[model samples]
Target: MKMFGKVDVGGGLSDFWAYIREPRPHRWAVWGVALALTWVVFSGVEQYLIPVDRPKAQIIYFENWTADRSAGEIRADWIARARETTRRNARKRAEYQRFADSLGIEYDSTEADRVTRETLGEEAAEAVKQRPAPPPRSTLAERAARGPQPEITD
Candidate 1:
């Protein structure tokens, strides 16, 4: 092949090279980017796709809840234990007993009963019969007021 004035101009290679070399926007790339942007705006950024029934759920939970009686039972059990564990006996025992009385629970103050309760099981201590039940607190009206639900929706 010898160099001459003849120009090479056949096939679409020149056009293809020109297209690749230039920084023109392609249709598919532009469409794909627009689709992705729209998807992100609608699906990722937007909220309230499915609303929550928070108030109803909270009301149901509030209805299901009962005042736990175990706390009072635990306190009575601890008091029964404290009666025996001497060293810091008299004053503290008397103070808590008075507090218990104030709370409408009758606590056994006798040292002998305390000893009997500690040595024998609680059944043996049943002879004195310390008030096992605490005074019930909180009427139905107060329990009904669970604060405003944040996600109350139509």
Candidate 2:
């Protein structure tokens, strides 16, 4: 065939070039089939063994490399819980104080007041027995008759 380069009847460098350049159509078809078969095998193996969730895989990999949590976020959550506890405790204490007051029991701040204790002898302190629970006031009409309750200040 004229299309074919000059073939060396004697085996030489030109013969080698011809061997590479003039591959048979059957050989090319075989190579194409081999490539297609390799691709199919690779794709099948990948589908069976390796998961394809790129985003979730990345997050899991990142967590493995780093610690599980952020310290700042944990600290903030703890602080919020503590503040809520403090507020609840303060409200409960206030409610108890109001109940005690209504029962006519004055919180003895005397224990807190060392100066008062030093000035007022033990005998004076003994004089302040639980102020006798005040007699319950009558109804609104009775209170109106009795006039406004006396205002007692500390």
Candidate 3:
């Protein structure tokens, strides 16, 4: 019913046009100041302001295969077999039995490897000294705990 306030939503553009249409120095100076301030505000916002729609990275992720280790017992059978390969190494079989007996658990290659490493101060690389051993057992727990076995390289 009544135009109460100077709330022309898009009427500012006509003022801009009016300023540019006249050749008065004051109008150009006003236009120049507005242009500078607009650019300053815009650049400041663009440089400093982050977008709301930008996907905020909740977690930075990276993957590496090198540092991984077994989540379960390392294979014991491979070590036993490796020991068996050498003439005096059959004694490793007896060690395996003894370890299992001591632990009150079944003789598992994984467990044996763990025992060798933890108890005997050894690494699985000792068992597969010069050759690649067979693949690890395929039981569910074994598969879950087992990591990628190192290849016995030349």
Best by lDDT: 1
TM-score of each: 0.18, 0.27, 0.23
Q: Is candidate 1 or candidate 3 better by lDDT?
A: 1
Candidate 2 — what's its lDDT? 0.62
User: Where's the lowest-lDDT run of ten residues in candidate 1?
Assistant: 57-66
Q: Which residue pairs clash in candidate 3? A: 73-110, 74-110, 75-109, 75-110, 76-109, 76-110, 77-109
Worst 10 residues of 3 by lDDT: 128-137
* lDDT tens readout by residue for model 1, 1-154: 8665586675468887786677766956876899999987787544566555565434333443346758888787777676556424543665686688667676766775576567556764564465444556654576678655488789
- Candidate 2, 1-154: lDDT as tens digits: 5955886656777777788688587978887899999999999989977868665434333343245668987787787676566456544544665577787566654443343334444643453343355467466788789887789999
Where model 2 places Cα greater than 4 Å from the true spot, the runs are: 1-67, 108-154
TM-score-better candidate, 1 vs 3:
3
Q: lDDT of each structure? A: 0.63, 0.62, 0.59
